[model samples]
Target: MITRSVQTVQTNPDDIIDIRQKIAGSWQEILSQAVTNPQELLDILGLDQALLPGAVVGSQQFQLQVPHTYIARIRKGDPNDPLLRQVLPIGEEMVITPGFSFDPLGEKPKNSHRGILHKYQGRLLLMPTQLCGVNCRFCFRRHFPYEENTLNREEWLSAFDYIRSDTSVTEVILSGGDPLALNDNRLAWVVEELAKIPHLRRLRIHTRFPVVIPQRITKELLNWLTGTRLQPVMVIHCNHPDEVDADVADAMKLLRDHGVQLLNQSALLKGVNDDADVLIELSERLFSCGVMPYYLHLLDKVQGAAHFEVDEQRARQIMSGMSDQCSGYLIPRLARENAGASGKVVIAPLYSLKI
Candidate 1:
């Protein structure tokens, strides 16, 4: 009798086309050393040892999750580093602020079926996995009970049945703790199933992998992604310009070269990207790297992340400034994800078009 581990999901090397032959096995090495423990993360970034206890408490449930690829981008010994601010499990995260609830987006009510989040019309979100490559403290779904929603083989069939019955679902969005966390074979299967629905015309993947772990953009992944029938669009998340390095630019280029449209959305974190100058730099850097600015999101008021919030008035001012200097295409929509709202509630509209 033979047994297999969950990590070792058997995938055929033949199914992996062109590029996979050249660079076959390297992600595992990166994954093995990904920052999971509190002390290792602090030591690597040269953050103060005194901050560890608070981080441990804050990350007790969610825990510290960061990739070595991402850590290298952070300025070592700087507690106030923007990249560190995004991932560091500080003591402030332990203090639950008022009016902040667990499910900030109200996704629980919108989950129409298992493994499905039908929030907006025409497009619905699918959870291929409940895990993210790097778990940011400010994630809207930090408190999402993904264990209950994790689908098995049989549950996946029911999810398929629900989608097949509804012709209105023309687009299937792969959202998760991060959809790109799933292996190429598993993700290919999910996309293939979505393509089977005749009404589905677009496949949108909401992930942070290309920013945090550029290595994730391998030939095998692209092969599975490009092989799909559904038109592919990847919405990558990047809050700061510094996150985009040469390697990241190359990864985005590969995706763009392969015909995948790339767009980016950023959270308006209080420390990370609040200033107009920082936001401007972020937009400029993103464009240079072939990624268009999609949305400059107002922070979601989740329980453990209130410290990162910037006032709506300040947020509009930043957008207004970006409007004044940058091209219209460079400016992103100022949107907020309000619970029970049909779509993203547009707080500040884009600048009026000049004919």
Candidate 2:
């Protein structure tokens, strides 16, 4: 069983504020403040040996990195831990493969405008920031050229101009390392600029901060999100249900109360949340907190993440098991992203054939 630290609270949103204020000065800051070096992060979590092994002193040392906020949420000394599986780097495979180029998804080639990726029609993904609270081991964009993609003030203006130029593009997705990592002032500024584009209908933010650092969902952040003219959508990256705690649930409630749609996109990792029961429980917990389970993505064929890949057959079986137990809404669509494909390819169940 996955063990977690629990806290109780009343239904009132003010009560949530009271809880946060009480812990504001004392509470640990994970990504933005506490964690600095990769090795020191390991010592804090007491995961130096289990994850690193003999490679600790070698030229290529395997490191155990977890944000203090994330570490605070974990039940200590559980090897089967899901959250640990995401951040702890194990010495498994090091050799690089041919097809796993820096730009596996062809993001750079498809960029029509600076700070914008126009892969799909009717929408443009604007990489507002190139920083995330915590870096996932299986990130497909681990090697993405962030230096080339960072947008300056004039560059952002040009991106907005491109959005206004094309009426077909109705949605603007604010993504990056994590959009919420930006302070309220910067986030509000970007939103204000996007609001001027008359053609944009929906504004979506893809972030992992709410799951990793729940304290980031401040009242000021919610005010800007709801105050916008375009419909606001937040897609949170959460691989395991254990990552969602009372703090995270409170954050989601704040957004839901102020008319922001909440959705989750989970990645299927071999040792992390590949089990059927874990996936089912994740869906149930997400629904209870008003966040819809959207997609269970297969691990992208990234070079460093080859250790996290489960075979295609095993993945399909897990999906089938989930379908039998949960409602269709709770069961997320199982899919994979093929390089240069028009859209995400859904993985269908296998059928037996006899000749």
Candidate 3:
């Protein structure tokens, strides 16, 4: 229905394949061009107008942002498309579900430094920016007070001081809206600073950029990522197999080829990837891309995202099924983040219950 003059190809005249254009331009340019309008997204996907009302309301609460590269992967006109379900603003987000709070992980109390979250024992999290390529509707930090946590160049010194004082800290995690959201120069400076600390041994980045905008993994980005002495580990968030395509595969290969370890962490969302078969395929896809399955997180109980949560029992059952179908290395550990916990709590599968 909608056509654009980009480097994409469209075949299968009966299917909605017009949006499949090659995504070019700088990552920043593509990021700036993300589709924020609910109507525009509906038009591009050939979705019905009836869903617009809910989308408008949901976007009002948490602005809708999805990159064209990611949008092209969703099955047009399919409201329940797994890829679409993750980003599509829906009325259910406005509901006040019980037990779902604005701060599910109690991160505010853990904000030890200007932009640092020292929740775990040996590692700390730094938030340099509050930007992401795509804003998933089920984000636990949807209501996070990013303003209080974001740090400028000078402000980072205080965080560095905090880490320097704590010799026990051996790893630093770059997290936020997504650390990759920051430009290479900024990210390089941050990594360089972390590498200066004699105690820091590894630098982990948690981001969704590779899935949303694979082009984010540019040569300059690779230079900073691999140049650092601290071991680089990228934990990418990908829920469904549909999110991985040729572009994403290439990006992952680049990171791996450059000696940057690649790992995937997925959320056990209700409609997005609840079935055993879907999770199995996702793990296989990730392995083929040179990434190992790491964590299958039980959805964080954040306000407005209760609809996405899968119960602990069901999560364990799904893990059991994955263990049965896939190799041990391909199966991710089932984990959850409890407030004030020492570290991520791993949930044992149902089959392991008898043992």
Candidate number achieving the greatest lDDT relative to the actual structure: 3
Please give each candidate's TM-score: 0.91, 0.88, 0.92
lDDT of 1 by residue, 314-355 (tens): 898888777777788888788998888879977755456221
Higher-ranked by TM-score: 2 or 3: 3
lDDT (CA) per prediction: 0.84, 0.77, 0.88
Per-residue CA lDDT of candidate 2, range 76-110, in tens?
66645778667755555365765565566777777
- lDDT tens digits by residue: candidate 3, 68-187: 888999999999999999999999999999899999998888986788889999998988889999999999999998988777667889889899999999999989889899999888
Alpha carbon deviation, residue 216, candidate 2 (Å): 0.9
Q: In candidate 3, which residue ranges exceed 4 Å CA deviation?
A: 1-23, 352-355
* Candidate 1 runs further than 4 Å off: 1-25, 350-355
Kindly give the stretch of ten consecutive residues in candidate 3 with the minimal lDDT sum. 13-22
Better of 1 and 2 by TM-score: 1
lDDT of 1 at 327: 80
